[model samples]
Target: MTSPQLENHLPFLRKTGGAWELIVDNKPYLILGAELHNSSMSSARHMESVWGKLRAMNINTVLGNVTWEDIERDEGVFDFTELDRVLVAARSSGLRMILLWFGSFKNGSSSYVPGWVKTNTRRFPRAQIRDEHGSLTLSDSISIFHSECVMADIKAFTELQRHLANFDRQRTVLMVQVQNEVGLLGDSRDRSLQAKKQFNSAVPNDLVRFLSSQFNNLQEDAKEKLGRFQDTLSLCHPSDQRSWEDWFGSSVYTDELFMAYHYATYVESIAAAGKRAYDIPLFTNAWLPKPAVGGGLGNLIAAGGALPGSYPSGGPISNVIDIWHWLAPSLDFVAPDIYDADYTATCDTYKRGGRPLFIPEQRRDAHGARRLWEAIGSHLALGACPFGVDSLEPESFAYTAQYKLLGSLETLILRSRQDSKRTFGFYFDEFEGQQADKGPPIGVSFKEFDLLISRAFVFGRPSPGCGMIIEIHVGRYLIIGDGFKVEFKSRSATSTFTGILRAEEKSVQNTVTGALRTERVLNGDETRSGKWVNMPSENPDYGDGFIPLLTPAGTRIVEAQVYSIDE
Candidate 1:
């Protein structure tokens, strides 16, 4: 299928059926991505050491940062020397790039802004927060209320985009992140004199109209939060101006909504300007809020806090995501930096409004690495990225093997986007002692049959596994990955029994050509005597006995067809 024509052949996001695909060079592209450390791309020398390792890890895309302070050390003067060098290296290494623009804000602080913006607070203006002593103090983050800060950011970002458009015509840069986890750090809402005055004034007519019109389409959590103000919202007119407290009620959440609107608009100005210079997919990442855990505030604080300021107030958390969506139309989507949050739940939440799901930052451990299956297979994510990969050795990288497998199945995965219901992806993680019961078998219903998928059977203790099942045809499946088994059941009412008819261990003949060759035709032990099809783990334990019912993993691909006996 051909992608829609876009301006300048720039990479864009398109929807196919109920799923989203990232189109590059007139074709659907799957990103096997890894994000570098924040400072890794600041110097070409530092990135030179990292590019070779990323290629070895099977990473197709590199998410790196372009700091305002580094690129524009002096006001109105820009330097793209380091950024250009890094781009050249990445292209030579056969890697795509997603540049994160660290302007005005980085993790709720203005530390990454150029010295001119940082030192001249009177000109750019810093946000103010109430201290513990109830005194208003300056925060490190710039005030979004001031146009000076956003205008400076827009100038720097537009220049960056213009440079990329001219210097790199190959389109090596696939996308750009507008900022890094933006929001206020010390307080729920900015308490500057101007901010106070604006808060007391009537709310924006545009925002009031959005809430009144799109109320039904808002996320469930957002709806719940706004439920109390339903009466006021219903009775309000589009031109009616009311104080923040009077419109949204008296609560800290109202403060969050107020800040979310400003932050979204602040980002919109930069993103919209950058798009005008050179249109490419642009998005921002959010530092998600952590629900209270272990019954203590310490865990909350460590997990980025339960309240707004505790965790970058006014950022695009789920509760305030609708506000960002309404206000930040220039941003392609709002992505989540998932750590210490429910990965699957976060994916579902961000999938609101039919927006694409692309994890910009996540954990680098095995536990975090395994969840990408659900993100891609079930949720139809454009990509999943693990942060801080430059520091890890290629062999030690948890996603190395996963990326290799995914790279091989990239064609099939992308094709499944058109009919995602015929595909499913799942994973089972290693459990603590006696906790294996929690990892129950997954059941999914297809057009013709039902599938019960579980950890690949072993005579000894079972090992953790992850894989995806795609229905190549009715009653037939192509299974990929290690440590999984499938039991098929017929949906027909008259069917008495269902069993595997044929199971073949297969290897990829050519990934580009999408050709497969069967290595072995298995019957008795491998298929559990026709009861199921087993794709054994990398090293299946045999309980130290003579019987060899289980075998070690091979190519980790299997094709199985199931049949039913109708009574």
Candidate 2:
């Protein structure tokens, strides 16, 4: 299939080499972004209070909401006044936007839908869930099986895109999220009459064909989750009439698969319609499932439960992501709203099939801020945005320092995208007590040698650190950020010893050109007596009143050259 012709002048996603990059003004742009609280963008005046603060935090992009209820309050009526004002305000502040469309569903509920749609249950039916007592009750979410509801969403979303195409002439809005965390909340699959009728019918031939043809290429998590059901794909014919249960086993996972197929198709309709109106990048975000912490409903809601209904039944969690990828052709990608889940694992899963990793939501804390390095440097992510950033002060925001450093190195980072295989990112979180579990030392192999990267060496307790290493040359590396040290070793069998020949602390002399100037010649105590290249913490502990063996972080960047001696 041919790709859609996106407007060249506007911001869009493009695949370069083995990774994806966001192109803005015809250049690779990285999104140093943060998401405002849900209601923060509803009012222009309210957003005014936070735009300057977001800028202060070095956030170039803001993920704000444009709800259905706000845009299409009355039936067939559309209002872009407030949205336009907010867009103008953001542009004035020199910030881009990613508008999240809270249509039909927000956090697995139809609370954001227009009141008319909510009241007219007969026309736009609510999804029904089967309670534990076997009684069917209405869920707060709309049923995806209903065509009227889907049509309404498509119409509203299409109008929104059309308005953006005309109003956002400067391309201030980079992308649009179709819906917020959509899917059934209380049930695995909708139990409404229409939903049940469709559920009991034959599985869609197209979906069957996709699974059959793409089974080998499916993410490992998806393949393993399929279990014995995977065998059915090889045996069953696409034209064969098989019920959902017949094709997949009768379990909660089967219910989830069923919901996923419908949800993806539902989103496909909306996303396709929007793209037809205005061809720009579009995506949806998933409320990721969290580990069960042995608590009840309250805990389950706070920390997403493992089961399907426990977390928005089928909102493109890793296992069902392939269905979304195959079925939702119009969406640029599916993003994960990560909170407590394994951040690296989630990045690896979503980045399958060469999709760009752009985190729409995550924890807004020091711990969460540190993971952005891994997402951008290691995974070659387009960007990552921490959630509810407006709630925190810019002075105290955890992402401020990280974003500042990343923004300074944005030019160099984008230039290295083609050689991402030679780059690595890592982080160490501050431990509560003396016994530090900073994870095992990460080992990275290059063409000439190897590197053992560990927490920055300090005389006292280690502080949190995050950094990335880029192999600018065969034996030379550009180390950025703080609180990390690198130990080089020879990969050749004949070489007996490998050590840092020279290490220089460098500062960004020109942000636009990415020009650097040597700030200090790091050696002796700074490089651990030439044994390793030390990028010490901002405040390195000296332990006792003696000769200071470690220097505090300066420039938070180092250029090191390693040499090996042959036996």
Candidate 3:
């Protein structure tokens, strides 16, 4: 059967179908994936071994990078070579990829720009910031115009998209990140003399016209679209050219508007060019650290400037959030790179756009990993990824083959809806954390299991902890964080079902080493002795990290009182 047009399928993420509960398809298929970086660079030689490990983990999609510096090597000279190698490796490995454009900005750095651009300030200027030294710092690449951001750059990015589409026609390379962690820093706005000149001038007309049609109440529309309007129609009682505060409401308006507009233009250009190459979904990811401290003033600048009302706001409520949604017709969706505290709240922030929610990056916590699954089920997230896939230490609890499977199954996670088992979560805060987020708490989903999240005693906390007493009553709970303990009861999934008498184990391993092994632990009195080590011997893959697989369709696991691993 022919695939749906890339345009048509983009909205599928927000729509729900089927019986048990909120669904994205006739069945649920939430994403569960891990990210591997610093492990795999923009090189072919590195891909093979790295991917073999990911495959072992059952990880499907990869949030890979096709850096701008690598692509734009010299003035007018573009290289698709590095990008080519990565794509070939990913295709061969059956790994879908999210290509992050390490362009003009990456984690607030001009470091990614080619040597030529960095050296020649004359051709491609910088965002002029007044450093403490009284001298100005050429910061904020967003405001800097370039000799390199040519049709050539756009065309190169476009061609690269087509090249991947040739091999990933089956939809393996699910999305392409327009740029890596695009943000502004230091000053709330750019210090570019050129940017300043433009800001002082009248707002653009095209932008104004666009906002008029999308929003009601000119004032409401003006607030959402703020800062950058290109010749807006003078409807609201003749145009007096609204004042600075009247125009955008916040101090940000201009800078955010510029960043959003710039990003939109790039994404739109790439998307348009790529469609000429092949047809598949394309998405962008944001680096959302703390809306403030983590990403710098850039978050305010970019998000504030956005005409968010332009995109497909799916559920709950809506408002303009970022420039990503408005600028590009070719771009399918915008996502977030979630890190730090407040998983549910952060996800909710993106949900305001009401577009499909996907966490392109996340922490590699065991408890967090499980929460990711819940996130996919609850928030309708397309997938999730953890940072630094390869360098994890041997003792790090985050390092495990079990997670690879979580990553692999991510693409099809939306499929495992009510048919999948729903679990529980725990925490300990009086009227905060889980305690305050009453009701289903917006993270995990199990159809009827509108998960009751509250601040209980943290999992590994001791006896005197009031929140520690009542553990999740479910037999299964996915773990992500480190240093947590749970002592309690769960309906014996095995004991309740007849002919389910078996203790299963499987070891997930590295394809090359074959020597790698996964070991399950014994907890509580379940081990049957002073022996904390002699639990039942089950080798799912003989200690490999993949799921219930000593055999196929494996559901065989002997029930135990508790599970704890001293990683």
List where candidate 1 sits over 4 angstroms from the true fold: 1-7, 234-238, 293-302, 419-421, 544-546
Winner on TM-score (1 vs 3): 1
Across 1-567, the per-residue lDDT of candidate 1 in tens digits comes to: 443336467898888888888888877899999999888898899777788899999999999999999989999899999999999999999999999999998898898999999899899998898886778888888888888888889999999999998998988999999999988876788999989988999988888888888888888888887775677877876678788888888777888889999999899999999999888899999998777632121212325777778788889999989889878989899999998898878998998768999999988888778888888877788898999999999899989999998898888778877666478888888877776454689999887899999988987778888888888889999888888788999999999999898999887788876678899997898888999888888889777666878888888888999899998
Evaluated at residue 519, the lDDT of candidate 3 is 45
- Per-candidate TM-score against the hidden true structure: 0.96, 0.96, 0.63
Residue 360 error, candidate 2, Å:
0.7
Local distance difference test, each candidate: 0.86, 0.86, 0.47
Expressed as tens digits, the lDDT of each residue in 1-567 for candidate 3 is 532542433212334342122222222333446666732666778766677776655566677777666776765566777666677777788776666766665654455767776776776677675454546676736444333453444666676666665545445555566655554555544557776665565445555445656545233433554533433334342234553334444544444554455546655676677666655556666644332333222334323222221111110111334445666667566666666536777666665545566777777765455456445545656666787665554246342544444433332233333334333323322133334323222233432122233222221221110111111233233322211222222233433221111122223244322222324443333322312112111221223343331222221112222332221
C-alpha lDDT (0 to 100) for residue 262 of candidate 2: 91
Clashes of each: 0, 0, 61
